[model samples]
Target: MDSKTQQTKWSQFLSLIVVFFFWGFVAASNDILIPVFKKWFVLSQVQSQLVAWAFYVAYFVGSVIFFIISLKSDILQKFGYKKTLAVGLVLSALGAFLFVPAASAASFWFFLAALFIVGLGFSVQQIVANPLAIKMGSPQTGAHRLTLAGGINSLGTTIGPILLGIVLFGMGNKEDSAPKDVNLTKIEIVQKEYQTHKDELAKNVLELRQDNQDDPAKVNEVIAIVEKNIADLDTQISSINQNPGANENQVEAYTTALGEIKQRSTNISYPIGFVKDHLKEVKMPFIVLGIAFILVAIFMLFSKIEDPAKEEEAEIEEGSAKFSIFKYPQLYLGMLAIFIYVGVEVSIISNLPALLHTKEFGGVLEHNIAPFVSLYWGSLMIGRWNGSINVFNMSKTTNMLMKFIVPFVAFAIIIFANELSGKDVSSFYIYAFWILAFIIMSFIGGKAAGKTLMIFGLAGVVMMILGLVYPDKEIAKYFFISGGLFCSIMWPSIFDLAIAGLGKNTGKASSFLVMMILGGGIIPLIQGWICDFDKTSPEGVMGITWTHFSYVIPIVCFVYLAFYGFVTPRILKKQGITMGETTAGGH
Candidate 1:
């Protein structure tokens, strides 16, 4: 309740945001998986979106379960924040571990289950962390601390796609030295002859189809001949490859050729009956992520993390007079705000790969989509970083300059990392100007979470509208991607508004708010269904182009958020509530 106790705990704050980074990393990386799953399984848009559904729906389930348990007892209060965090990390690690089996089996449902486990872990973390961030510093500047933590979260989002791309696509990877199992002399002869035969046979089959246009019998005969040749060539290559006397050169050539055959063949099947090469590669990064979570959990067990609730036990007892968090309309409305905000944010980013892959949209190559995904998530980091500047202990002038500089600094970091990963970032340079607009909006609304929330929410709505309107224009891409920039500050802003005066109920309120993460699950599914435009039906009935029309989901979401932002402050004022001492000393 006092200003002195409210000063930010810098070291503890830094320690806490590690979980935030993990949340962002895994969440954004789901975008990459969506397209991959769709292509591999030949899934409908709705079917592939089970990725988002399985992952985000866990939050609602976990939070509801947590809330029910708390009806009898406060779990965080009993277990303590540090222990709760460690447990969450362990759960997350367990989830990541599931990816190993999921990928090994190449089971799509297994992958969903793995993501669900991860989401459950994140739910607990969100329940604990959101309230914890607010309580870490002065009640006035609590929003700023959360914003700073979100900036760290955004950092993970920015890097996740690029790094995961490397793992999945083998981009920029160097070939290892050739294996020493090949019969070098015979290997060369076999490989050369195989390639010659393969090419000639493939060409002959194509010509047979064309030349035998009126002779099905002749076409079948030529196809049979080519198929037999291919089968015989494979046997010869296999015999040479398995020979112990084979040299490294021969082994390498044979290995490379076999891989090419798989790549070129339309109906390629994995011999292992589970993980294929690409799926296995994708599984590697997640397995490593699982290991990292375990290590972090171990560290958390030993680390001395303060529980803000414990420090204010007496005040909490006093504030405990109110048991039901829903008594406050702001809390309930804010809960919906969090839900819609998350739903729209996830829907846009998760579907971006699909949108870009469409011939009607950007049509970006599968492997090349990482950088654009990075841009969407990175844009969030830029806005959050800008908002984070207010939380730092700096002169007013310094803060202003940094507000402008920090986003572009974050932007530079994204561009640099992406460019190094082989993505051309030149088109994204214009986004910095859009970022400048974000900066201007930040200063215009100052530091009031509710006011700024309204402003940013409206801005988000505008961006979505532009994206929908000019769905095909190059400029529309900027409009759609800039939605992240507008959305960056909303989580902290809405959280700050919703829990402003809830006192002891803040913890319960946090759970309810976290439950709204269900929106992330449902909204994308709805968009996917809409994206399944029945081309067979008369046009325009579904609203817009299937891809573009789906964006309307986000537009409606932002509209609700903007209205919430506009009304919440007035409601708080009528109830004599004000966030006491903001980082900028306002409101």
Candidate 2:
């Protein structure tokens, strides 16, 4: 590449990175929204997840419209990238502004509508930005550039949960008292009491453990004896209370005795369970905060970008009517690849927080801690960053090997970790496995675009199946999070492969690709309906559970993606034009 062309390529790469960052921030915020809506709207588990369905479904719907427009014989040749992006920005901004009203009225439908509009805007942005990134550089460098963009996008994901957590959960007291209106002294008292309770619980658990080991057979017998004595003391105190002539000092002594007895009972039982239960009770505010955070992210995107269509005209003249890009079989298959990739990605992230919060799966951590789901985002960032750097260094075959091996190893680690910890493994283990998988996949992606994605897609299907079959919560969460590792490269790889050679027609084809994001919307809703339906039982048999149904979404998405990976690229080669080329459009 020449110096001037190199500079232009870098600039274009930077612009797409910004777009990716925005999308990552906006898209990942939906993870926070699901639990938030569940709390704010008092929705059922399935109902709350509709928040994701409502937002992502727009990608599919909007992309279809854009795909149709692109078929109008080089519509992008008439409009250009700058103009298309500007229009998308405006629509996204309008979507963000809608949140203010949605929040004020607490209207769920309004929020969904706003998210749909935002999805439409993002669809346009995706169409324009993705192809532009590839065209500005060589295919070797293009994936790297997109991966860098994915990294910045992960940064936004990291910040989003923390920022929203502070806004929502940090402001509240656990005792059902509104921190916003409470006096400082009362707040301090509440905090002190909370800390005291936590400390006391820790001390009691240690004491109970010691007691249990001191005499395993006699511990329960001793506990029952202590409980009976306490109950008898309580009855004696009540009898004293019934005496009309009881002295004030006698009453004070009885009260003190009752307090001592209660303390002894708590020590015997180990109060850690009670402390954890109280912490769970304080999660409502955190849920609300998560919702607010996403609204703010939507606002940020809307304010920052503009609609590309309104900005400028394309330098290229309209192409002859002889060639039609839409008629190509590879192009259609490529669109399917994009669709499935997005669906798999969305399903993976959306389900993580819920899995961490499910008690049946031995969720010991509180939901407030669930926002740390950003750790998965952090892992993705690491992968994309390394993938970008390695894109230039590694050969296709070497990179492909790493991608396949990395996820497999990560899955193994997660399975081992879950087994070791058994039912008591912390949620942090989920994040660890995710990071490990991402690292391996990044090395694997190298420069072989189509094959890299194919590997990831197949891995996604395997992980989803594992999650469905496993009854263990920790194992299920591990598989779900590991799906992220396999999924990390599918989006950019599939995109670059699909639009490989469309010259002047790249922008229009890009639009078609963006429209496929509607998969995010459609798949999640379908999953939601499936989950809801499963919860409804017949007379004798149990209903389908979320664990079983959740697998269906990713399985369906990956099955398509796997097909696209193995078959779509070869089909593209047969077409005598890559996804980036302006060939005679064929179906």
Candidate 3:
């Protein structure tokens, strides 16, 4: 390439990286939002997860629309990359500002509306960015460029969670004031009655002992008399015996007392009900976030993109036969791979914090320790950094090998480190595993083939299953976190491979690809539903645990990605393009 062309390509590359960073920060921030919304709204595990669902579902819906448009004529040919991206940015900013009202209203649906808008903005950004990046470089180095972009994106993701955590969850406020209509009066009345009864029982026991101290038989007689009197009083109090023609206040008091007794009895009958009820309140934020994500889809109609190449192609096609890009088998497979890969990624990050805190699996670290958990995200950033640094100098086979070996070794070390530390693994070891996995995946990913890198996703699934099967051990718990290292490169790598060729059709293809992100939204909701189901079921029956449900997500992700690894690149090749060569705007 000439110096001017090289510079143009370089400029585009930098711009796409900026785009990735923005979306990465936004996407990963959802992790922090999940727990925060859960707390703020008092939602259940299932409901709180809609934050992911709302955001990702827009990708699916938006991309499908873009894909359809591409079938008519490339949308970029009509609009252009710059205009399209600007619209996306404006929509994103609008979505961010929407949070102001959502937070104030504390209405769950409002928050979801904001999140849906944000997701719509992301659909545009993603659809434009991936193919554009591929266009800027050679096919072989496409993965490397995307990897670099992924690293920057990871950095944004790392910072997003930390920043949002501080803003939302770290405010040192624990008292969640109840809404106006929830009627806490009943609870307060019950509490007061229980306290009064407790005090009376103590006083009666002390008096009975004192009254019969001189003779053992007298002591027994006094005790029996006091117990009978207390029992009679308790029966009257529980029954709330109201005389005929009582005043309104007295009637209310009597009914309140009876209701309290019934509630107490129910609590005794079902111990987990209270916890489940509270969990339901925790999911309100996620619902709001989901709605917000979908609302932004409307912005796409007004958005436009700039592409000089697309304009040139349009002129040539003025009298030619209309071509449909959707007929390409390679593109279909690529879209599926992206959908599955992102789904796995979202599920893993969403669940990692909870998994690390489980006492049954030796997650002794408290939620207060954000630094330890940060390592999981930090590793992805580090791996991306290494990929960027060496993108130009590495061979394909070498890159593939490095990617595979790093994650494998990282998981192995995590297992060994946990076992060696015994019951009390220092928090430092937890941090070390994070650092080690990042280094390994980064180095290996910098040299491995895109296909080989995708295979590591399977390793993550296997580790999650191990964690579920042996929930009694700390090592099993560590495996789930370790899966992060293996998962680190899968998204960028698979993405670069999928849109390998489509030339001017790259923009539409990118949109189609971004739509696959709906996997992230849907899969987690499924997992959350499963978790709620398990929590509600009988202990020893068909009930599945949260950890077990987590295993299913990655297993499905890897199984699909592995198929893509072997077949997707070839399909793209058959379509007359290599796995990393297609360019629309930048990817």
Q: What's the TM-score of each model vs. the native?
A: 0.79, 0.63, 0.64
Predicted structure 2: lDDT: 0.55
lDDT of 1 by residue, 333-379 (tens): 99889889888888988777766644334335457678888999998
Q: Can you tell me which runs of candidate 2 are displaced by over 4 Å?
A: 1-5, 8-16, 44-46, 60-87, 131-143, 171-327, 363-366, 392-446, 500-505, 538-544, 572-587
Q: Against the hidden true structure, what lDDT does model 3 obtain?
A: 0.55
Off by over 4 Å in 3: 1-5, 8-16, 65-79, 131-145, 171-307, 310-329, 353-373, 394-454, 471-473, 496-508, 538-544, 547-549, 569-587
Q: What C-alpha lDDT values do all the predictions have? A: 0.74, 0.55, 0.55
Best prediction by lDDT: 1
Pairing residues by index, what is the TM-score of model 1? Answer: 0.79
Give the winner by TM-score: 1 or 3.
1
List model 2 lDDT by residue over 292-352, tens digit each: 4355445434442333332223532353234365666666788877776676677666665
- Cα lDDT of model 3 by residue, 329-362, tens digit: 6668777877776777677767655444332332
Q: For model 3, give the 10-residue run with minimal summed lDDT.
A: 172-181
Candidate 1, 405: how far from true, in Å? Answer: 1.4
Each candidate: RMSD to true structure? Answer: 12.1, 14.9, 15.0
